[model samples]
Target: MTIHLSKSRLKYLSRLGLFLFLLILSGLFYASCNTQSSRNQSGKAHLGESPMTDSMVVDQLIQRSRSFYEETGMRAEPFDRFLQEAMEIASRHNLLWQQVRILNTIGRRYRDRSAYGEALRYHNRALTIAQNINNKGLLSEVYNQIGVVFRRTDDNAIALDMHFKALRLAEETRDSFNISVAINSIGNVNANLGRYHSAIEYFLRALEYADRLDNTLGKAINNHNIGECRLKMGYPEEALEYFQKSLAYNNQIGSRAGQSICYNSIGAVYIAKDDPVTALEYLERALNINDRLGDLMQVSISHSKIGEVYLLLGDFAKADDHLNKSYELAKNIGSRFQAEESLRLLSRLHEANHNYATSLEYFKTATAYRDSILNEKNINHLTTMEAMLETEAQRNRIYQLNQMTSEQLITLGRQRLMLTIIIIIFVILAVITTLLIYQHRLRIKYNNLKNQHKLLRSQMNPHFIFNALSAIQVYVLEHDVEKSTKFLTDFAKLMRLVLKTSHHDFIPLKDESEILKYYLELQKLRFVSPFNYQITIDEGLDQENTFVPPMLTQPFVENAVEHGVRLMENQGHLDIRFKKLNTQMVVEVEDNGIGISSSIDQKQKSGINKKHESMAIKITKERLDVIRNDIGGKVSLEIIDKKNINPFDRGTLIRIILPIVSQNN
Candidate 1:
């Protein structure tokens, strides 16, 4: 196998062999480089497809990311990578809407992971881009995502504001998906605020919209929210049903995170149902899923649930371990609510274990956290309430100013019209003397009618104001600040409504009903004697779209409350009814109190409330007259003393007929 040679000849052969080997090595390297270049060229060719094919690729990537999101309920590794690739392609192609969409997806992922700062940063960037592109749909979605971030961070006020803003944008664009999302977000905020009824209402509405769109994710979330609301409302059985429904939907979509949430919710319901064994089963399932998904916030919540189940089973050691783990995880994620719950459970566990000192320490910490949370919630509520009150006050002031300005403009317009008419009459006086005379008569009649109308409205203003002030003074004299504050708020609202509609000839029947209800409530508050009232509208009548003269029946109602029911020995009852009868609107105001005749006699003899009685009658007559002339239709008011029909029935009844006016008219 070996060949020997002389030294010189062997050296020459070794040199020659080394040279050949170096040549072969260089050739092999060159071939390998050529093969790699060809492969690179092939890959480049595959990537640089037709424009249509590139667009398809981007769309496919985006769709894949969305599918992954639906499957995982948050961003899985594949989902993130897919979105990244799509983002790169979208950015390079200047596909702005797609870019914004991808950014929103990423923001939601960060939000789901409890990375609020990163979530907000991404959402804000997407918002900027969406606004620059004037993409309302994208803008709405980004706003929604940002709202979720704020909600997760417990900035409920800001979160609610953002959700409302998103709702407005979504509604404007008619983006059904975004609309449902925004509504669901708002429901979550309300739930956090402990407005479970309002939250349920919002969730139901969102669910309806989602059902119409067949959106599985939306359905799953809404169902979960409804379950939480029901659970809070003390309906464990109902809550369990909703939670199971949510789980079904989540399963249908293969949403692991959603399934985890449902498992936790179901566990809560089972605990409420006093089935600790079943609860433990669900809690463990939720914890396993949360741990695998790396959802620290959810993990904390799940552990706390498991701890609660263990505590219910009297397993102190297990409870302590789980609760401590929950507390640590909650602290890591900055979830004060979860941390507080865990601490509270820990305190209970320690107390059960007879560790009095440790129990007290944990109890103190839990109490501190609870108080802090309550303080934040109260501050938020009070701030929102004050702002709303201020806004209403400002609106009233602005409306009053506008009303004054409008009246001045109307007076100026009337003067200009009168001057023009005078000029025209003078110019054609000789040529059309008879016509001018007839026109002059018409003008005089119109002016007299207008004066009567203004006089009737003015009469209502002072009488109502004086009575309201007198009632308010009673509360003030009693030094009842709470009652006085409440009375003042109601008075302000009524005054604002009256002032707003004072100048209008007609307003919606719905608005009139609201005013009547408010006035009745205010009157009831003033009187020591209690009264009951019911307002019924015919189902056939369109209260919102039907129009009638403003405050047409208000004077009669006032008379019933003030004269008939004010000093009644027994509790008085009032019934008001609105009906659509053929071409006319019929209203009935009946009161079970002193007869009108008796009331009139009492007031006349005492000389008290005489002026109010006269003004009421005067305004009623004048209003009827104006309405009859203006509409050129049948209008009548009839007052009946119930004693006249039957002496035992001591009450007053009034019926009125008005020409129907549609909203458009």
Candidate 2:
């Protein structure tokens, strides 16, 4: 080793050593490359028989699972199995995108089953993968899915935050579909929080995006959401229109679940309109669809709505049956909200049937369910806060790792502070607007009450009293003691009846009939001409049960007796009839005397003042308008001149139609 060598031999040996080291290095590099290639190929092989086949297989699996979930609803076992297999395939292949999809599917399945904890776990995993891959599209979908889970769990604040994140990412990525989905989800959260106008605005934006994308499902869902918001806001007519549009879209898309929802919503609108028969028909159709689809949740809702319809129709047995079925189905499905609704309806049904004890039990159960809902909301709030704290911790850790400058950090803090200030301002404005609306409604109510009182006073006409007193004075001057006594007694009774009835807004039909009888008798005695009168009442009317505004028919009767009968040369006849027509009471006052036109013409020729009669008619019309507003029904008057039809038949027929209301109503 220490032998001396020539300079050329030493240089050749050094070069040979360098060549051997280079060869060793090259050999090691090739070995590492081969090992990595083998590992990647093996991972790909584990996913399927071949790389090409793996993609097809995974796609087919995803499509099949999605179809099954859509057709049925949250069949957890099958869905979980499919999702697990897809996840394993994705993991083995190291497919980050595929893993995100699989994890999101798992999260959705868990959410559908109401397992919020498990749902959050998988959604968080998907979010991690999306962040690692730095895929904005994938991140948007993950955020949206998480938002939907949070919304379902009643964590509205977190849900709204996630939806806003998703919307931002979707817009950045130019993902139209995900943007629409995010907007719709936000709308749903707003609706759940009872911010109907905000919900509607979001839904409309979603609808616009959905229409641009030609997404039939998105369009239908957005329409349905708008309908729900409108319904909640007490716009049943507008809600019904939206629901019909949704139904048409659902039908076009062949979406049975959407169709069922639309039908249920339409039925609810009809129920609000008090058209129970039509509501029943729509609800039954929805029930049939839900039954066929095996959608227990929708079935439960349909049963509850049908029960409401039956209750309205006074079919107690049917109402009891449907409500019990609704309760059982809702219980089976673990839908506490639907269960609470069913219980409330059952309580109302039992109360309607006069079972106070049973109704109280149901009411207590409903209250307990309501309390449980509130507790669940509180729990959701705690969970959302925990999630937010965790997210903040992660952000802090991320910020520490980031190479952002101090100026950038300060700017971000300023931006956050500004955002907070803006939100506070918005909330304050919303509160102010709500207060203003409430104050306006109070003012309108006060004005209505004041007008009602004024109308009541105006209804007590002075001309009739003066004329009656003048007629009584004539009898007193004639010294007819017996006739004067009989006339005075009838007149006193009539005056007392008018005074009593004028004090109240509504009187029983029987009481009004008695008042009218006394009034006509007084008029007959006061008049010198021979006058005959008949009163007919429909057998179908329950006079004691039906109520009408006091003094409704008196003005018309006074006009017939004073103007028509008084001017007649021959024997005057008056016919008064009360008949019940569906929900309305029809009062007909027919006088075989001078028509209204002839009476007016005669008054004009005699230079007589008929201003009081015209004023009374106007007041009666105004009173009817007020009564119609109070009772939520129509009150109309029609005048028919018999002389117009036949010259020989000189008379006026007045018909007053009024809504029949119950005392409790």
Candidate 3:
């Protein structure tokens, strides 16, 4: 082993050692390359032009784009640039998941801008990619986003179908977040369809899911939706409670948009309660928030709501200013619904000020806008239906292609026969359902008409006629020719007015006001103690144009005079104020007399039967309910016992809100 060697042999041995070292280095380099190739394949970054090494760079781009989309308030210019860059990176690296995400974000941005067609295209592309990849979670998100686009386009039926599909997929994959989103979307569709109870039910279910998942944003949105449903159903008190809860949650989460919406809802509730003074405070807060957020649509709504409050408060100048601002903003933003609402309010304001020509123009413009909205909805519905039909045809063709063998062909023929039979059965069922619904609607209409007639009979009570005749007879017997002549003339006019209006359901507010004036004057002549009476019509009321149910306010007015004012020890005072608030005619009848409680106490002590008074009020309530059903407007009565407000103020204040019944209807 230690044998001596020549110099040439030693040099050859050293060269052999160096060659072995170089061989080992080359093998290690090949192993590293193989490992990188395997990682690229597993990461799905090997399909495109860019190498796997660029995936990290593309991923960073996607993250930056997502952060921009979430953090920035949809600043379109910057967002568009970022999204385009991200999309290019994802495509270059063939990042399928990132592409899907980027596409969805673009779709949502288009949707927020109300570009429905563009939104649908992007979402559908994302949906196709998700389907190709068999990604259930991504599919659920794409389906939900597509449903929102359909909802915004007014294809509510299709929207609901899409959301249900999303819910099914999300549930199957146990995706809590997407499940909550789908449920909330379904609720919105129901609400848009005017199924308020159904909407609330869906929203409540969504809230439960959100609570389970501890999703603060989901809970906030669900609560807000529930509040909107309650408001639509005329449950203002319940709506207020839900809105407050939503506001709290939004505040905790620092959602400016949610907070703005909650504030607007709370303001609307106050408006409905006829407290315009308080309503303005909340509406202004919403306006400020929306302005800060640069949400033009929301700002328009806030302006409109504030205008409505000002109108209710009899500040026509302020009302006009705000409504005009709302109109301009809505028109600029292409918000047809808000623009139409503003136009309607403007028409009413002009009519109230006796600008008939201008009012007519505005009314016509509002009607045109409304028709356009309806047309848009119809177009969207037809488009969705066509799409559905095309999809069905595609499915049928796929079924045909799948059946190639003789046995399969025979099975296909049998399936065709079965499908024809099923179609016939469905048609029959649909016809039957249609007939049933038609019958139900007719029955409801019949009941409403019958109730309206009953209300009319109650309004023209025989006791009221007898009391008027008795008062006139006393003036005749006194042999006071001047008083007797005036009494007979007024009584004849009253009878004629009643006869004229009794045959119809509604009369102009001006006519109703005249009737009250004559009736009150006659009552003053007959009363033993002198009382002061004043009737004030707000400057913002369209007395000649606005129509209301005949004799709606007379009963309350008669009650105030006979029961309340008559019982007062001192000279009584009666104040009647008429104003228009939103779509309603608000009549406030106040009497500084013995309070209703004291009057009832005296009556009970004297054992006087007051059945007629209760009956009159009951009939009035029923009449209001009928009007509400017939016209789709809210009618309410609030009787405020002044003693509750101030112990020394002894009287009853009756506030009646009558819906402005359309004369054309």
Candidate 4:
């Protein structure tokens, strides 16, 4: 077992217990390597007959797995079973954070084996658990692991998204290890995408963090990634320096996986230098270590590189053998990338050997895989563009921060003071502006009230009063004293009601409805051809508690009665409805007589020379506009001609929407 513990994880264990546990793990690994005992037997022997609590068992299992990680390195299969057992125990005990850790570990193992689908499944499970626990540290670790899986699968866009999310969460939680890991992972994606310069920037930033934490593993990883970017940027000598630095760190930490990667990277640098002899030594070293560790992904890559070197040296037989093994291992691990490279090398080797037909077949298959990969790369380009823009912005922000000075601090303070002064000035201007607007609105309201009083005084036109008085006198001369007295009394009541309520801004719906009834009755009395009128209020309305602007609907109702219902040759009908619609009140005055358009044309032909516009209507609309402006409420007047709906139908329908104002109890 190869076990590696993070600095943060190691903080949980006492030095004495960790040392003792390492001693036991070393002996067990030694015995397993020598075939003295089965791996399962060794693990059980260490944990058997212990009366530890569930938490202790989980801790021991986790520590044991960590030891396996160190000893066997990235070849984590030997410890995977123990970790699964730990996961089961932790789940049974509802140890949520333990489950997240175990899931992330297993996911990484799957990632190492190039089982991307299974890796994502485990990581997603970890992500869900971490989110449920609301633990930023666990969430960051899981996001970083998921990002690595996507990067390996050549999904750079998703990889960048995941890595950035991990970086943000790690920064929020001050998880230094994860922050470095996430930044380094982003660099790897950029390097693979051919953005070597951008990749180098990220690598250097990540290195700064790793150095601060003195995290040997983080340092090795960042150094190796920087080497990759440099090598891709065509700086083989510079790349060698970084690779050596990484190798030394890995050696110090005894990281077999990290050492393997450094060896492979160095080999690649030598290959770029056209030094096959030197490259072969490093390539073989990586192959041996990866083969021993059972990391098929790295093993495949190593074989492909070694085979390429052999082909370069004109060693066809050795090249064919290595390339075939590389392809087989890559295919078994589902690594299409490695398989494609191996197939391409094999095609070249066959071509060199004059095997034209076989070479062509290999070339065709490799092309198919390459085409599919290119299609995936096209999708990645969209994310690549976005990542480039974001990375540039991040660089600018970092540069600005790094360039800050004492003088800049003084300038910043001055700017802040200026901003405060500007805000105070703006506030004063806003208050003055508000007062001026209020004064202007008050003047407008005063003029509207004046017009309203004038319209109300005009409501009792001499023509209407004279007509009512003449009707009363006719009833008196006909000796109908009771009818005369009743008509006179009703007319007086209507006049008084309108005068009393006209001065108020708002009156109760009950009082307003009473005024409308009284006016309609007096008008009905004056009509020679009598009309029936109905006024209804919605049952749901609390008429006494709800108030509306006084007489808002009176003009429209008067128009309907006078122009629409009064001119009918047959029996006329007037219907007024006050209904509630949601938060607004709806008032509808519908009359069946001559429609509004017809009445206008009739009056024009009859030489009624006055303009058709009613003063009462004009004043009422101004009042509604004021109401609408002041309260920002819905107040509208819509007149619908029934003749437009059907030519034979004659009537006008008036709808007034008023804001509902109710007194709070």
Candidate 5:
């Protein structure tokens, strides 16, 4: 039916209808967004200098980056401009040391981007440059850089070897920077190996350099690292002190990234202290910064942390909401570490609520991720080597093929074009098949490794740092020149290790043992021979062939003296022993101190007065998982409570079992 209406009435009806439609559409869009504010979208507190709209865009970019990772994997267009720039810098600079330095920088860029293949290429090129220059100093630096590549690729053994080389180089140069760098690197390697005492000594030494050089950044990093290591070794109060020092430097620098990390770390400490509100604030802060930075990696972690806090707060829906976000982000970012960690938090949360089936499902997911990451890390190493070899062989073949006369090649090209097509088809098909299989494996592996790393990188907590300077200050004030000299020398050596090894995975056993022995001697001087301690190893254990996780057993020994043995009224006694087993080594740290209780482990978990591991034990466990899974070996940990389990045993019994491989292997 058609009806003619007055022009004024028709226009009025049209305007009213349009207005109604607009209102309804706006309501629907608002509902879809859950009414999120521009600032809240990034989940950050509206702190100074943070704009709402800017935060929203950052959140959007973060989402986009995750989507990008999911769609394109880690295959970002290799910043060819940057690589070329570095190459040009290397070439134009006649100094081989400068070339090595540039190459190392390029390698680090690739490493940060998770492009191990490209990183390896640059690192190897740097190594060649160092060799050509015959600069032991550059060689040492290259070794350390190569170790970084190994750690990234999950070869802790090789990583340690390179770190050792760097440490030796540092010693040769007598340069405090390299010495500190090398020492710190070694201690970190030992810490990763579960030698917390060694890690502590190394960090203390690093503090010395940082102080000597007046390097606030280095000091803060080392202190933070030490606190992180101590948290694993079960020293909450000490860890917090270290973290505080770390924060001071980070604050002074006004580094948003460092601030975010410190906030999250502080939150972990608060959580350990049993404060959820503060934890949430810090986690949210970290999440906000990570979102703005388009760092899904850190965001996923913050999400999981928030989920954990919510779960503790008994908010099921809230917990699930954040956990789901975490999982989705982890999956989207192709970070198996985060996904697995999210699954774990979900598992624990559900299990606590008596949701066994759901818990099992989540647990299964976590396990799968764990396994997948391990495999991927392992294959990353092998595939990297394979890719390089294949590229080289192909290049050589291409060069040889190119050498033929132009006419001969043209005739050959025409004649063999058809036959070549068949062969090419077959080769292409085989390659595609292999790649498909490889990709499937790679996907599973990458996700798995991501989950493992997610848990380890959780913010610092209940941190600790051992300050040699304070002790030295005390000695100097007391006019104890002999003690001061000895302490200073040990301090210098330890600092050298920390500066060198902060970035490594594992270090040579000989080097680690040397540092540990030195640390023990220094501590003995501080204690004025309160008790004598012996570090005994079986035949062949000292060889570079036998390697352990960084900083595994040293802490328990230190704890015996610091908390247990030294507290005693009588003379203290400690026993540190190491024995190699078939493909494994058993390390025991026993002492005469106040006995351990059955509830100690549980107390440790709750972050009560008991020793706190922060994420140290978990990190070492994860790093070991990385090592064992990558190397086709197994690693295990056991802590023996002195009182309940063994009445006769007075102090703590810290046992470490490590996989033993031949030097070549």
Candidate 6:
């Protein structure tokens, strides 16, 4: 049946019986690949949801994005800036997974926007990162995302194969959410192959899992699939049943897009039964949703359906009007199914009116699209298979591991030398276990550091940009042209520094310290004389060689100025000191302003986080989760005199410590 189990489904293996059998036979956990890294959000915005609804914004965003790229054949600078910003945020805080996740999101967005080539690039970048970290989850997600692109490109076979691999990973990972998705994807491929029964079975299986997972969106999608198959089988009544149910589900979830799809499919069924009036009503409703959502794919499909209805109604001119519109959209988006459907309907409409030449032209176009679709499916199938076979080969490697474990044990009776060797091996195993524990700890440490770096990077820029722009605006408003010009120039230079550092693996301590000063200077312009500051860098400190996190210390300084100094009655004195003590390099920024209040918890802290003071702090903590691996040096944020700090704090003190490095090339 080629019913590949996704990692999420693999989690059910024990309960499902398949996993238990494999586990008992293998004597170790065989990876059910929950490799699909991203999860399908249940139908929050159904195909039936209104395009104008807030929920449809995401779909709308993708649709507009695709049009922009397709027509220009280029991505806008703002889009790239957003991506770059995401990267910067990830890098400064050292959040590798978050970075990869954001990259995946961008790729998915691009793919939906019909920027396949860009989508592929971002997906590959994410894949490469996931591979380096051996993050099976992330790798699975990238594969599934890549597979989705292929599916959209009309390489159904290849898409199916990639989806199978993704399913295996999802199963291995026990990710039920994506398992249902992978299952439905396979059903789609089978449907394309004309295996309607098999497709129904797959969809039904997906529905079972969806029900268990409480995934309403998945259920609706399955319903839609069932409706399509039934319609194809000439069961308009049955198709209507599924379509209506799907619409209800979509309505429950507020999925306008889902609603649109249901309407379109239902209209198609009615049209097949030669009920043009009902068809037009439903198709018109579908078109309204499509126009709002701006879903080009659905737009193409809806137009074709509308044209078919018009043709059947014997409205030659109206049918031709809709057909030409559908044809352009279908060709532009590369939807063979829509293109062919539109062309065929156009041919019939023309022939009915005795336009033989026009009808022949459309017939030829439909034939060409049909052939193109067929060729695409064939190539896609082969590609999908190649990936599946390679993954299967990886499974074979697991067998080799099993064989090795078996060979390591003596099958024959025990001997004196053998007994001694066994003891030694056991001891070695214990030592290795300890080493792995230590290594895991180290990994956690590095991961935390990586996360910390990313947070700092994310926090710094927006803060700087905001303050800089404010200063520039204030000067320009006062007609201080030269000052306004200077502020912008400085902002530009700082921005350049930020851009340069964004791509780097690390930055010099000197440059890192300098960034904080520029950041502080920008802030000073905003508050006027709200705060005062001092800077101390230890003598003989290797300015060029000493490494410090970019923007790591800036937040603390800014926090002190905004929350600590601004609240105080007296002149707020902010002190910054950097010193290398033995192997440890410490940077302390202390402020004498209003103290932190004991009443307010960390979560309520304002002016610090991007969202809240605590948000920035929490983000930093989450990002530093990787650092839990290392027990050595540390980075921390603590209010020195907790009682002295206030929500209207006198001021705050932040101390950061890290290992000092001597080498810089």
The CA lDDT of each predicted structure is 0.80, 0.81, 0.79, 0.80, 0.70, 0.70
lDDT of 4 by residue, 45-142 (tens): 33332335877888889889988776775545833778989988877667777778788877777677556666776777777667645789888898
User: Candidate 2 lDDT, tens digit per residue, 498-600?
Assistant: 7776656677888888878888887887777869999899988878877776777877888898888887778899999999899888899999888978887
Error of 6 at 218 (Å): 1.1
Give candidate 5's whole-model lDDT: 0.70
lDDT of 6 at 603: 28
Report the Cα RMSD per candidate.
Answer: 45.9, 45.9, 49.8, 30.3, 53.3, 37.9
Which candidate has the highest TM-score of all? 2
For every model shown, the clashing-pair count is 0, 0, 0, 14, 60, 88
Which wins on lDDT, candidate 4 or candidate 5?
Answer: 4
How well is each residue in 529-590 modelled by candidate 6, as lDDT tens digits?
Answer: 65678889998578887765466566567667766776666677889999878877778888
TM-score of each: 0.44, 0.52, 0.51, 0.46, 0.46, 0.44
Model 3 regions more than 4 Å off:
1-79, 379-665
In terms of lDDT, which candidate is stronger, 1 or 3? Answer: 1
Off by over 4 Å in 2: 1-50, 68-75, 380-665
Candidate 5 matches the true fold with a TM-score of: 0.46
**Could you tell me the lDDT of residue 374 within candidate 2?**
81
Clashing residue pairs in candidate 1 are: none
